[model samples]
Target: MDENEKDRILKVEIDVSGKLHLTPEKKKFTLIYRTATEVHWNTEINTLYSPKPRDWTYLEWFKHIIKVTKEECYCELNITEQTEWVNIPNELKKEITKAQQWL
Candidate 1:
């Protein structure tokens, strides 16, 4: 996937009514959250203009699931696992930029 898509995935948040916190599937990138009950409480479905308020993020939704199911839940995503970033000295950055200008 492209960097933009990766960034988007990193920022993805969805509310679900299932036991699973977040399930990433195909179709570009789909996160399926399953709660104990079969009822769907997606905040996206209740848009801002809708009668219901759209105030639940994925974390909030998951918390609701925990309240209803009373099950221990934990989800992890290593977004930066593939990339490492370190501070670069200003002089080194200038040198790198100068070198790039030659190419």
Candidate 2:
């Protein structure tokens, strides 16, 4: 992976209001965004999923329920920096390197 791409500022708009409105059994945390390259996606999943359209109500199956009901979520990336070189973890570096090798 290019060092320049590490800190690429991607926009992700997550709408959790629907899930929060559902009953415990009927509702769960689901990914509101679907475009892998558009929004930062988990490369771990193999299938290419459709981008969650604006009018679409239910979320894609790829999305999983949030394990915790807690209000605080730290998983959201800290994107205050304008520089194009975010520090990534060693595991992600390995994954990025591996992906780059195929190119």
Candidate 3:
């Protein structure tokens, strides 16, 4: 696989509510988002990283999960810093404002 394909294999997205989502690039539209509640602590997130098992030992899988998650996080952080928000959804903005009142 090319670099782009490798990078695109897994992604992390943030929602208006500051919720994190894990989705594959091609299936981003179909899979949409998998919220924390929807993800199983062990199995689901690993599956999101790679649907098929990699024949890795338990420790290997653990290390891979940490490495990939960190890489994706850093990738997002850089992209977010460089990009500008052209438009913010008013409804979600308002919802956030209203929710912030509780704090």
Question: Who wins the lDDT comparison?
Answer: 3
For model 1 the local lDDT of residue 15 reads 22
Prediction-by-prediction clash tally = 5, 0, 0
Regions more than 4 Å wrong, model 1: 1-53, 71-103
Task: Name the 10 consecutive residues with the lowest summed lDDT in model 3.
Answer: 75-84
With candidate 1 superimposed using the best TM-score fit, by how many Å does residue 102's alpha carbon deviate from the native? 56
Q: Which RMSD values do the candidates have, in order? A: 16.4, 16.5, 14.0
Higher-scoring candidate on TM-score, 1 or 3: 3
What lDDT tens digits, residue by residue, belong to model 2 across residues 23-65? 1221222442331222222334211223344444223211221
Candidate 2 similarity to native, TM-score: 0.20
TM-score for each model: 0.21, 0.20, 0.23
The regions of model 3 sitting more than 4 angstroms off are 1-54, 75-103
Q: Which stretches of candidate 2 lie over 4 Å from their true place?
A: 1-85
Give the candidate order by descending TM-score: 3, 1, 2
TM-score of 3: 0.23
lDDT of 1 by residue, 13-95 (tens): 22232122222121121122354333232353221111122465333443343233222123222222222212334553344
lDDT score of model 3? 0.32
Each prediction's Cα lDDT score? 0.27, 0.26, 0.32
| Cα error of candidate 1 at position 42, Å | 13
